[model samples]
Target: MNWYVVYTKPKWEKKVAEQLKNSGIECYCPLITQIRQWSDRKKKVEVPLFNSYVFVQLAESERNSVFQSVGAVRYLFWLGKPAVVRDEEISVIKKWLDTSDCIDVTVGGYQIGDSIQLESGPFMAQKATIQEMTNTHYVLVLESLGCVLKMKIK
Candidate 1:
């Protein structure tokens, strides 16, 4: 069985994953623990690493079963077919999430005007250009998205 990505309804990734698993479907919804702060308190919470998406291992025949699960939107399609995720990619995600408490990623050796791809977060797989930089942060211009982002690298 190959791993395919499925989109879920807003804020429903964990719920959909649980429902699918309960129905004997193998699903993976990676999560990261983050400390959220309020005026009076800070608490650690598990949030979906990739919001609104879950990975499932199944054959073509099992697609309908997964679709029937609550909050499942649809499979992510590439080249007019359901996108197949490589095992190595899944392994990398699993390993990173398993080992890291708080993760920070930075790409070095990229010159100004060089395009770089974001590997994770809300802009996963999106390309942006290095516009400016300092010792601790970068200013990226996302041309297609029509926005500029200031992100820290640590």
Candidate 2:
């Protein structure tokens, strides 16, 4: 089975994940807790880590089954094909989320403007180009993904 990214309706990640699981599809919707405040009180609520995305592991022949879950819009497409996430990437996300304190990530001996492949954590396998290095962070440009990730050094 391969893991595919599912695009879901806004604010429906958790609900769709639950429905998929009940139907025997292995799905993951990573969540984080944040302090949401009203005018009178504060409460910690769980929110989707990546809004509108849920990961589902299934056989390619079973791809259409995901649509049975309400709020699942479609499979995310990259390069005109269904985006396939590596098993290591899924494991990394699970491990990172299980830990409360963010684990230490080191950029050993790498200088600014170096191109490197991450080997550890949830960002593993992401193509990154060094942008700027600071005492507290590593600014990386992910060209393939067309985004800059400002990662904090712990």
Candidate 3:
């Protein structure tokens, strides 16, 4: 059996994982606890580390059953074949998640002038450009509104 990543519907990572497991399929959906603040109060919530994706361990013959599972969209493909994840990579992710309280997963390398967006904050949904970066801060320019904001990296 090999581990393959399955893309799921939005906000369905956990649900799909559970469904697959109930059907005798081994699935892994890593989650992280995040402190979310609202107007009322702050609460710790478990959120999927990889949104809309779940890793399933199965043989190639079991692919059809996984695809038939609820909320499972499809397998993540690379070069026309389903992408296979090594056991070491999965173990590393599990280890890091187990040891770290806060984890930042940077998807790709970013350079100056790259377009970025604020995932969460007052400026949520706002798009900006990476103007400059120092050892401790990021200078972002909100191009749509002609405003600049400096944020200290934590």
TM-scores, all models, native as reference? 0.72, 0.77, 0.67
Query: Local error of candidate 1 at 78, Å?
Result: 1.0
Number of the predicted model whose TM-score against the real structure is largest: 2
Candidates in order have lDDT scores of: 0.83, 0.87, 0.79
Q: How many clashes (backbone atoms < 3 Å, residues ≥3 apart in a chain or on different chains) does model 3 have?
A: 0
Error of 3 at 16 (Å): 0.6
| Cα lDDT tens digits for candidate 3, 21-128 | 899999999898889999999999999877888999999988889977879998988779998887765775577567744433232477899998867544556688
lDDT of 1 at 33: 82
> Worst lDDT window (10 residues) for model 3?
99-108
lDDT of 3: 0.79
* Candidate ordering by lDDT (highest first): 2, 1, 3
When 2 and 3 are scored with lDDT, the better candidate is 2
Model 1 residue pairs with clashes: none
Best candidate (score: lDDT): 2
Q: Residue 94: error of model 3 in Å?
A: 0.2
Tens digit of lDDT per residue, candidate 1, span 1-154? 9999999999999999999999999999989788999999999999987778999999988888997788999998878999888776677567756664445767689999999988876456767999998899889886543347676777
